[model samples]
Target: MHNLTSDLALALEVADAADAVSLAGFNARSFTVERKADKSEVTEIDRATETA
Candidate 1:
């Protein structure tokens, strides 16, 4: 069974992964934005971070 400490660790790990993807994209500043079917903006970094 999972406890609070393990759950928190997993959450932090996921957050770190997401941050790394986002920071890399922000630093590179080369990603293109596209409009989704709903007319919302999204980029490859967004998808990558979500996957992370």
Candidate 2:
């Protein structure tokens, strides 16, 4: 049970970090889009969010 609490807390912290990255990049003036290897459109924001 103690470990569960710690795990949940860690997950929440990670989510917060990811959100910060996404929001920071959300309105980037020079943001661009490109096709991924699978032919899907992706943006700098998406990569930043994932990298967070």
Candidate 3:
């Protein structure tokens, strides 16, 4: 149980880091969602968000 709590905390920290990067990029750019021929939204922000 103690180990489980520690692992959960670590996971939360990683999530926080990812969110910080994503938010920073999102704020730095004007992200526009464009629909493809298949009707899917795509943007450079999406790649940045995932890579971050």
- Which structure among the candidates has the greatest TM-score? 1
Question: Which portions of model 2 show Cα errors greater than 4 Å?
Answer: none
What tens digits encode model 2's per-residue C-alpha lDDT throughout 1-52? Answer: 2689889999999899999988777755578899999999999888888878
Ranked by TM-score, the better of candidates 2 and 3 is 2
Off by over 4 Å in 3: 30-52
* Candidate 3: residue pairs that collide: none
Q: What is the C-alpha lDDT of each candidate?
A: 0.96, 0.86, 0.76
lDDT of 2 at 12: 98
For residue 27, what is the lDDT in candidate 2?
52
The 10 consecutive residues of candidate 3 with the worst lDDT sum are: 43-52
* TM-score head-to-head 1 vs 2, winner: 1
Instruction: Please give, for residues 1-52, the per-residue lDDT of candidate 1 as tens digits.
Output: 6599989999999999999999999899899999999999999999999999
Best by lDDT: 1
Q: What is the C-alpha RMSD of each candidate to the true structure, in Å?
A: 1.3, 1.9, 3.2
Clashing residue pair totals per candidate (backbone < 3 A): 0, 0, 0
Candidate 3 versus truth, CA RMSD in Å, comes to: 3.2
